[model samples]
Structures are given as structure tokens and as C-alpha cells.
Target chain A: MRATLMPVRIADDLYEFSVKDPPEARALAKALGDHPLALEVVAGLDRVAVQFAAKDETEVSRWLNQVAAPEVTHEDAADPIEIHVKYGGDTGPDFEAVCAALSLTRAELIELHTSLVHRVEMIGFTPGFAYISGLPDDIEIPRLDQPRTRVPAGSIGLSAAYTGIYALAGPGGWPLIGRTDAKLFDAARDPAFLLTPGATLRFHER
Target chain B: MLHILTPGLQTSLQGTPRTGYRAFGIPYAGPADEVSMALANRLVGNAPTATCLEITYGGFEAELEATCTLAITGAVGEILLNGTPVHAHQTLHGRAGDKLTLSPPQFGARAYLAIASGFQAQSHFGSTSTYLPAQLGGHEGRALRTGDRLTALSTGQATATLSTPEDLIPVFSDAFALRTCESAETHLLAPRSRDQLFNTNFVAGRQATRMGIELTGPPLEISGDGLMKSAPVFPGTIQCPQSGIPIALSCDAQTTGGYPRIASIARCDRHQLGQIRPGNSVLLLRRTPDEAVREGLEKQTLLKKWLGSALP
Candidate 1:
């Protein structure tokens, strides 16, 4: 897919250029690494953020333009992880409200959520918390009016047009629909995080 | 060995970050004041990124369960070894059964304790730095409590003799200056506001943490419609939320945020931000990218020089 590069500044010395697509960003990252400046590639689904140190905004802008080249597709694509979840209970306090809002039974909602494969668009909020896209339109739910003081780790939640899994217990406003047993983040592991942007994920009812 | 007789405020282990995991939404959680932390490590001849205790607001009392060399840096606090005064930045040999007491800091907020061979703690994400929210890193993923004992990895070398006078130790003071550079959202603010930003003195608000340091100042009006889609944020980012008050991101800041950033504090002056306590007034000076890079490089060179001299 064709992608456009957008130059964005993160800090004084840190300038980032985001590619509209992942392939182009990865390609740019590979090419830019040969340059004297260090290049950090932060990949998202539709965009890839490349950060570098620069002397000025003009120099950073020039570098960003110079690095924008033809997209190179990755040979080894990201793998999809399948996760099982127990939906609707005290663990998922907002599950019933979500089902009622969607005019569907808990079973139907589970079927809808499980049927479609989701792509990880981004990861944010906390460690290993993947923001997955491509959820079924029927399962879309709004976030809570008041964010819970603390969201338990592995709590699967939905808000607006996105679905996410919380890796750490912290304050969040997303509507809880289920809980997953899969440990998304384990610092002891070699890679640390199992899910990366562009990786696919499928949810199943336990 | 260091035995915690009393753990005051909050204290945890910290070191250089475990990066390359930010894509997983994990922040590279490390020492808040990296420069100071490195200096402490250097004084004790430990690796620059070695794990150390990050004590906040002091009031911590520990007994030297075994003889060891240690150094403290960052905040200006009273340190006593066996009820006698001890220097904060210089390495000291604590004998077995010696009691170390740290009173509340008279200036600044946090202090770092570095051992000769560094503190031995469990590794998380390849580092001992604690990310408290995730309950990861440090000793069992939490702060040190009373009666907790910490073992120092065997340090064959003795304490370094201070070439510089004791008074030369970098101590905290109220008159610290923070440096800044224009951010992406600088254009979104009123044209005159850019000039006003450098002219205005802002106060550090109570709502501050490792995640972000919120500043209270004259409300800055901007022409932007609303918050943009969440984008990656780094330390030194000066983000203005709906409240219009600017907040500077710190070590534990989120990977991404939707707030409009006004300016980013320069890397050289970030330590000043870390040392600032609530209600402290700060003046923001505008800097160009070139100026920021030069300053950062200069700071790095100084750090390297100090490290080379301090280490065996």
C-alpha cells in the first residue's frame, strides 16, 4: 500500500516522521539506519513513527523527505495471537450493559466478538496493552462515563471504535466486557511483550 | 548489606531503561533523574546504569547489616551514619551494624543511593528499574518496607577518596532554571502567547507525578479545536490538557497522549524539573533545536568526564 510520510516533532532533539503505512515505515527505518543519526522505528497499523536527533527543524524536515522512498513489504509478517476470555460477570461488570445497548444476548455478543480476526493497530495506556482494530460493528460499545479508579490486569475493554486489553492494573474509563488469562506482558520473557503492532489477534469464548 | 529500619515516603530500585519494548505500550521506566543517578553510580565506581535505590522525600533509616561503600545524590537531605553526619555525594565505608538515617530533604524531592557494586535486585525487562503501576521491577515489584534487607553485590574495591571538597557535592537549591524548546503544538497557541511563555513564571502544581509534572500558571489560550488523536509522547514534552495548564512529562509518562504540547524542556534542564517540589516557581526559557542539541551534548560530555574520573 502507498503511504505518505508526515514529519512530527516529539521533543527538541527527537523528531519523528510517521509513515501512513507500516511497510513504508519499516523500509525507511532500514534505509535510514545507515545514516550517521540513530533511527528508532515505532510501527502502528496505518502509520509508522521514525524518530531521530537533529540540529534544527529545517534539517529534520529535510531528512524526513529524503528518507521517504518506495515501500518494502516485510517477508516475515506479524503473527496473530488467539486469546480466550470469560465474558459477563462481576469480573466484567459492564458486559450486560453493553449487550443491552447492542440489543443482543450475551452469547450473540460473544459470537460476534469471536468470529472476526482483529489487527493490532497500536499499543498504549500501559505495557502490553494492544489497541486492536477490525472489531465487528455490532460489538462496538461506549466507554464508561467515569473511568474506574483501577482496571484489573487482563481486563478486555471497549470504547468508541477500539478494543484493548489492559496489561497492568491502573485507572481507565473503557467498558469492561470480559477478562483474558493470556499474559500480554511478562518482563521476565526474552521479548517481554507478546503482541506488537501489525500482529493479528483473535478472541474466543472460554 | 543495607537493612531498612524505616522506609519513609516511597522508595524503589531504578536503573537505565529497558527500551525496544515501547511498541508494546511499555514506557522505558528508569531513574527519574538519570544524570544524578549516573553521577551517584560513578562516585561509587559502579556501572553507570547499575541499579540503585530511588528514595523520595527521604525520612528513610537503614542499618548497615554489612560493611559497604555507598554514595547519595540528587536532593539536599540530612544523612547520618551511626547518628553522626555523613556526606551525601561522596562514597563512605559503612561498617557492619552502622545505622544510616536519612531525614526529610530540605531542598528538592528525591535522592538516589548508589553502592560500589550496585544494589542487587531482580531484573524486569532486563533492568531493575521499578514501574510501580505495573507492579514490575524492584524488589518484588514494590517499594522497600521496614525490616527489609537488601544485599549489595560483592564490591572488591574500597570507597573512592574525594578529590573534590565535600562542599562541591551537587546539592539541591530553590533557584534552579529549566530550559525548553518549541514543541509541535507551539503553532496552535496564540501568536503572542509564544513570546509570553518564556516571559511567564509558572508554579509547580500539586498534581504531579512520575507520569507528568503539571504546572499552574496564567491560563494559555490556544486556537486548536480539541485534543488530537493519541500520539507518542516523550520525557520533557510540555502538554496542555483541557485545563490549559501545561504539564511536563517525566520518566513514567504514558507512551502516547492526546493533549496539545506547547514546548519540550531541554534534556539538560530536565533534572531541574525532577528536583522541583510542589509550589516551586519556574521560568521557561525558549531555545532552538540547535541550542538544545549543543547543551545536551555538553551535559553528556561532562557526565562522561566525571564518570571516567570517578570510576576505577
Candidate 2:
């Protein structure tokens, strides 16, 4: 555990706290995440970026040291939310290329991918785009060398072990293994983003 | 409300940034040049957070439906009211049915047009700023297009004229310098790469946008292992990808990134950042974090003194 508190003042209103430990950092993240004064809790790998309003830094700093960090369950050990996907067609143009790169048949690929559940590490890039952790080692791959100018929304993409869905299609480089019809973000929905950090996710072939 | 005759470059409605929701991957969309936007809003008796049109590289035309007090700020563009020359940095009285056009394309990028009492818009996640990627807020969640009409909160009764204080006016230049503090991972860079960041007069590339600005010069070669674990990144962070090209994250940048950040531009210079055009060359002047913060506070105090109070 990081005994002392050392926060890097990134900007006039932005401060980043490094806890070194992921869970403890997440604990601090969750503890003050939606706190009225903190404003936004932007969590990084092992740090929580507290962006406060101008002139509120002193008060926010005081709120930081005394706050209790609640225990947050790891996504890997949490209950899984099933995601239905369509592999290897218009929805997933890079499916064959991915399988060929990994030396796995379509069935083998599907079996390996669906077997171990993934965890939502963080939400980033675009609105509602969650970075999923824990892909099977055998199926791990890098992002495409040439990014597609326009990727379809709902595209399931992978770069290294991290898999995520492009909630709203735009420019993307992650190799698409498949696509899901599941809505990750919708303005009309009560909570716009369907996936939150530390949530478990499972893939089911449709 | 004003009717858009032509959207010109990329005109969108932006106000104060949508802060606090970055954890959900929401980009903090707002006016690129915040200081200029605030000044424009204040000139017309509206709060700086009021909704305003963000015009890019000039080429915009609009006709007013009602008379309103308006001020245009940021970038240098020729403003014409019904084919007559009008100047920026001063409040202009717009009569109903009058036409306002920003033309001739300024050397700088982005301009803010704020009307008195502000334009009314729905706030999504606590901001009216337009972020098109998610189609979230602002006028239909996208750039203001041709034939689109926007109504002011209240208008047709002109307010008293106000001109910017002579010393408070911004100076536009094609070349400038930004003071920056080296990042935590600065030691990871090759000594030459570190030197290039501060010494090189890097030119802003054509790929500049509200999301980020690409600076092209000598490729800032790095000898690090490879890609890094994704980490939190701020608007003024200057990150270098595998390509060695440095990218300055702006208002609409993602909350986090995987590339190695070389230096963070001082918060004081970000308002200047919005005015830097594609061809503009900039030097990343080095500064300590404490120095950066102190300079910013000083500037803020000066601005408040000139504006007669705290900035909106």
C-alpha cells in the first residue's frame, strides 16, 4: 500500500493521485467518484484523476486524505453480464484474418473466446466504450497496422488482450473479431453507458 | 435566434466544457479558446458559460431573426454586418433581419460568437457543449448545419455598446511558444528526443481539431520498450506515439491514453493553443510545475482586474 499521499498537479484544476496498487487506487476512485466537490473521477491504471473546479483545489485536497476507500470487487470474480455477438460476416470483416493470424479454426476460435469471461477494466475512447481485460493467451493479437477510416458501431475489437466494443462507429484500428447488437450507449437510457468499470462480461455466439 | 446560411468550416455550438463525466469516456467538449469565448460572452452581458457559436477558420454566414447584442472573439476574421465592415472585440448591435458573415478565412483557427442573454440549449450530463462522436448535446448533437435556426434566450432589444480594454485584446501570431512541464516519464526518452521537444520549432500539422492537435517536425524518436499501459491524460498533455509525432490533446480528447507523454503544456497556454492554426509553428518552452501554476494565477488575476471582476 502507498503509505503517503503524493498528488501530481497536472494542471491548474487537474490533480492525479498515484496509489501504485490498482485496487486501492480504485478504492480511492470509488470512494470519491461521484462526490459533489470532486466533480469527475477519471480513473487510470493505478491512479485516480480528480478534476476540480478552479479555486476548489484546496478543499478537494482536504477531502482526498481523510476519505475512506471502499472495497471494490474485482471484475474477474464478479457476476457476468452476457453479450450476444455475430462473428465472421459483415459484422466482423477481420474475423478470418484474425483466425489465420492466430492459427485457429473458426470453431476453435469461438470456443476459446467464449470459454473464459472478460472483465471491464475501464471505460474510455468514445462514449460507453469499455476496455475489457483478460483474453485467452492463445488468441491474443495486436491492433491492425492500418486503422479503418470508418468502423461500424458494435464492432468487437481487440488489441493485445484488451477487447472492447466501439459503441458509436468512427475511426478505429483494433482488429474486429466480431460485433454485438448490444447497446453500450444510448442517450435516452437512464444510465447512458451500459458497461461500468469492474463489471464482468461474457460472450455468447448468436 | 440566427439562421445559418452556411455552416462555414466546422461551426458548432460550444459553451463551458462538460467536466466531471470523464470516467464514462465522455469528452469534455467546449470552446477551444476558453479565454476568448469568455471575453466575447462578457462583452454582451451574458455569462461566459452561455451557449455560443464556435466557428472554425472563418467562412460562416448567418442572418438574425431578432435584434441582439453580440460579440465575436478568437482568431482574426473579417466580420461584415450586411456587407458592411464590423470589428471584433466590441459589442455589435444586430437589428432583426440583419446578416452577419465571418469571411476571408483567418490565419488562426476558431472564433466564438456570443449573443446577449445566451442561446438556449439542453444540457446533457451537465453541459450544452456539442460532442458529435456520441451525438450527445448541443444543437441536435452535431455541428450547426445550413438552414438551422437558433434563438437567443432573449433578444431584439439591443444593449449598450462595450469594447474590449486595449490591453486585454489578444494578439494573433503564426508562430509562438508554449511553456510546459516535463512529464513523469521524461527520463524514459532519449536525451536527444527530450531536447527536441523543447528546442524544436514544431509546426502544427493539418490534422488539428478540437479533439487533438498533431505537431510535425523531426520525429521525436523514443527508445522505450513499446506501448504502455493506458493512463489518465489531460487536455494539455503532449504525447508521442510510436510514430514519434507529438500530439497535443485538446478539449475533445479522450480521458486517457496509451502513448508516452513527453510534456504537458502549461494551463496558461491552452487558451493560446486554440488559436494556433495548421501552419503555426510553436516552441515548447520548459517550466517547473510550480512556475506554471504561479504564472496562470497571475494571468487570471490580471484578467479579472481588466474584466472588472471574476471571469464568467
Candidate 3:
């Protein structure tokens, strides 16, 4: 843990705490997230931002002063959410391109993809778009040279070290390998997002 | 009900920002110009958070189907009631069948229209503001189209005529010097590039929208490889990409970004960002965080004094 965590005021209603460690930053976000004044708590790669209705740094500062760095371990994870995917067809438009680029057969690619457990690193881009991390270094893929103006919702995309779901149909550049039926985001749902930061999951071929 | 005779470019409903959901990749989508929205609402005797129409580049026309009072604000040029010229920033009474038309703005890019009781809209995440990309909030989660009808939330009863004081009206111009403060990655910019950012005026590129405005100027050089972990970005955040041009995030911008954040427009000056038109000249004026806070509070105090409890 760092010697001290200081919150930097970025805007009138926004304050950012720069913590280099991702897990600690997420832990810090979890600690201060429930503050009454905190409208939103977002944990990013190396920082966490707390948003409030107005400028209230004194209360946030007091809350931060009292927070002890909490340990984050896999043992603390809840039951993994299972997502079944339909791989390699029209739903997976870039499957052939990925197979050609990685020099793997269709069956081999699916085996590599389904074997490992993925962790939700962060959520961004669009509502409920979870950036699932833990892609093996060897299988890391590049984003498309030209982004599609609209990638259908529930489309599963892989790029660099993360796998993402197109929770809502919009523009995207990721290479899609499969599609899922699960609704990642529905404003009508009680908890809109299916996956949140730090959640773990595994994919299975349908 | 208001009958849409002609929908201007990207006219849609906006209300108080959709807060408390940024972590889900949702943005605080609301009126781009919060000050203008408040002024318009006040003239119509509605609360500051009441829903209003956000018209981009003006060119709007509508017919009132019920007796109501209306107020227009923001970057506006010519306004006509029943084809006779009318003024902006003041309350105007309209009877059934009266026509209201707004010409393209003379300077800025957006205008706001508010009714006495506010417009009825589909609310999402506790806001009526439209988030176009997500197809959420506002009317049918889309921009207004010709022939579409908008209903008032309740029957409007006109209050005493009110006009915004001359001193309180905001000026829209082609050139703006926005007050800004350093962000998470400000130090990463090279010394020469950092100086150039604050000293030079940038021309707004063609890609201007509620999401962000692309700016073109001398390429700002970064000292390092410029790769950083993806991080949270808010409205008014200035991000520098590999191409060196900066993009200023606005109200409808995504919750997170991967580009290097060089600076952020001070809260006091961010409302003006909504008025920025394509090809407008913009300069980032640096200030300390303490100075930014003071300026923001002072502006809020002024608005509160004028609008009373209506200023949120």
C-alpha cells in the first residue's frame, strides 16, 4: 500500500484519487462508494474518482482518512457467473480473420478461449460493457483496422488483453469471436449491469 | 401539446443530469449549457431541473396546441412568434395555434426552449436528457422529427412577465478563452508542447457534438510513449491522442477514456463549451485548482441570487 492516499479535486463535483495499484484503487473505490454524498465511485486503471452532487471535499477527506487499505484476494470472490457463447459464424464476423492471424483452427481457438477464467477489470465504453481481463499473453489480439459503425448488442469482442461484450448496439472496433444471449445492461433491471469491476467469470461454448 | 412543424438539427429533450451511474459506463447526459437551461426554465416559472428542448444550430419551428408561456435562451439569433419578430431571454405568451420559429444562431451552436410546466419526456435513470448513443431518455430515446407532437407535463398557467437582467445574459462569441486546470496526466506533456497548449488558439474541427469537440492546432508532443491505463474522464476533460490534437469531452461523453488527460475546463467556464461552433477559435487559459473552485462558487452564487431556489 502507498504511504498515503490523497484525493485530487478535478472538477467542482468530482475528485480523483491516484492509486497505482489497480486492486487497491478498486478497494479504495469500494470503501468510499457508500458515502451519502458520493453520487458515483468509478475505479479505473490507476485511479478512482468520487463524484458528488456538489463540492464537498471535507466529508470525502474525512472518509478517506478513516479508510484502511483492504486486501483483495481471489478467495473473496463470489460464485462465478457463467456465460454461454455461440462461437464462429455470422454472429462472430471476425472469427475467420482471427483464426488466420493467430494460425489456429476454429476448434483450437474455441478451446483456448473457453479454458481460462476471466476477471472483470472495469466497465466502460457503453452501459454494461464489461472489460473482462486475463487473456493469455499469446492470445492477445488487435482491434479492427476500421471500426464498424454498429456492432450488435450481445456481441462478444476480444482485443489486446481484454474481452468485452457489446451490451448495447453501437460503434465498436474489437474483433468478435462469439455472441451471447445474456442481457448485459437493461435500465429496467434492478441492477442494470450483469458484470461489474472485479467479478470473475468463465465462458462455455453453446 | 406542441406540434413539431420542423425539427432543427438535433433538437431533443434535456433535464437535470443523469447522475450516480458513471460506473456502469453511463454518462451524466444533460443540457450542454446548464446556465442557459436554468435561465430558460426560470423565465417559464419552472424549476431549474425541469425538462427543456435543446436545439442545436437553431432552425426550429413548432406550433402551440395549448395556451402556454415559452422562453428561449442560449445562442439564438432571430425568433418569431406568429411570423412577427420576438425577443429571446424573456417570457412570451402563446395561445393555441400560435407558431414559434427560431433561425440559425448568429454566433453559438445551441439554444434552449422551456415551457411553463416543462415538457413531458421519457425519463431514464431519473433524467429526461437524451443520451443518443445509448438510445435512452428523452422522447422515444431519439431526436425530435417533423410532425412529432410533444405534450406538456401539465397545463401551464403564465406567471408575471419576467426578463433576464442584462448583466446576467451570457454573450456568445466566435472566440473563447476557457479557464482550465491541470489533470492527472498534465505533467506528461513536453515542456514546449505544454507551453503551446496554453499559448496557442485551437480551431474547432468538424467533429463537434454533445460527446466531444475535436480541436486542431500544433501537435502537442508528449515526453513518454503516451500509453497509460484507461481511466475515468468527465465532461470538460481535455484528452490528447497520438495525433496530438485534443478532444474536449462534453455532457454526453463516455465515462472512461484511454488518452492522456492534459487539462480540464474549470466548472465555471464549462457551460460555454456548449456554445462552441465549428471553426471557432479556442484557447485554454490555465488556473490553479483553488482559483477554479473560487470562480465556480462565485458564478453559482450569482445565479442563485437571480433565479432564487430555481438555481440547482
Using lDDT as the measure, what is the rank order of every candidate, best first? Answer: 3, 2, 1
Better of 1 and 3 by lDDT: 3
Off by over 4 Å in 1: A1-8, A21-36, A44-65, A70-115, A135-150, A156-160, A171-181, A189-191, A203-206, B163-176, B190-199, B218-225, B309-312
Give per-residue CA lDDT, model 1, range A1-206, as digits (tens): 44545566556666666555544544565566555544344544334454554434466567676554555765445555889998989778889988898898988888878998787767776788878777664444655543465789999987645678888887666789999988888876877787876688889898
Q: What fraction of the native alpha-carbon contacts across the interface, defined at 8 angstroms, is recovered by model 1?
A: 0.51
- Tens-digit lDDT string for candidate 2 (B1-312): 699999887888888788777877888888888888888987898776788988988889999887788999888578999999999999999887999999845467888899998887767988999998887778989888899999887755567798888888888878878889887556667889888888999999877888777889988777855355566777888877767788898888777776777788887787777888888998888988767777877788888875656642
Candidate 3 clashing pairs?
none
Name the candidate that leads on DockQ.
2
Model 1 CA lDDT for position B170? 64
Model 2 pairs whose backbones collide? B1-B150, B1-B151, B1-B152, B67-B156
- Model 3: residues >4 Å from true position, as ranges? A1-4, A11-13, A20-23, A52-66, A71-110, A137-156, A171-182, A204-206, B310-312
Instruction: Report the poorest 10 consecutive residues by lDDT, candidate 2 chain B.
Output: B222-231
In TM-score terms, which candidate is top? 2
The per-prediction tally of clashing pairs is 1, 4, 0
How does chain B of model 1 score on TM-score? 0.94
> lDDT (0-100) at residue B19 of candidate 2?
78
Cα lDDT computed for each candidate against the true fold: 0.73, 0.79, 0.83
TM-score of chain A of each: 0.74, 0.76, 0.76
Predictions' DockQ, in order: 0.38, 0.53, 0.49
Interface RMSD, prediction 3? 2.8
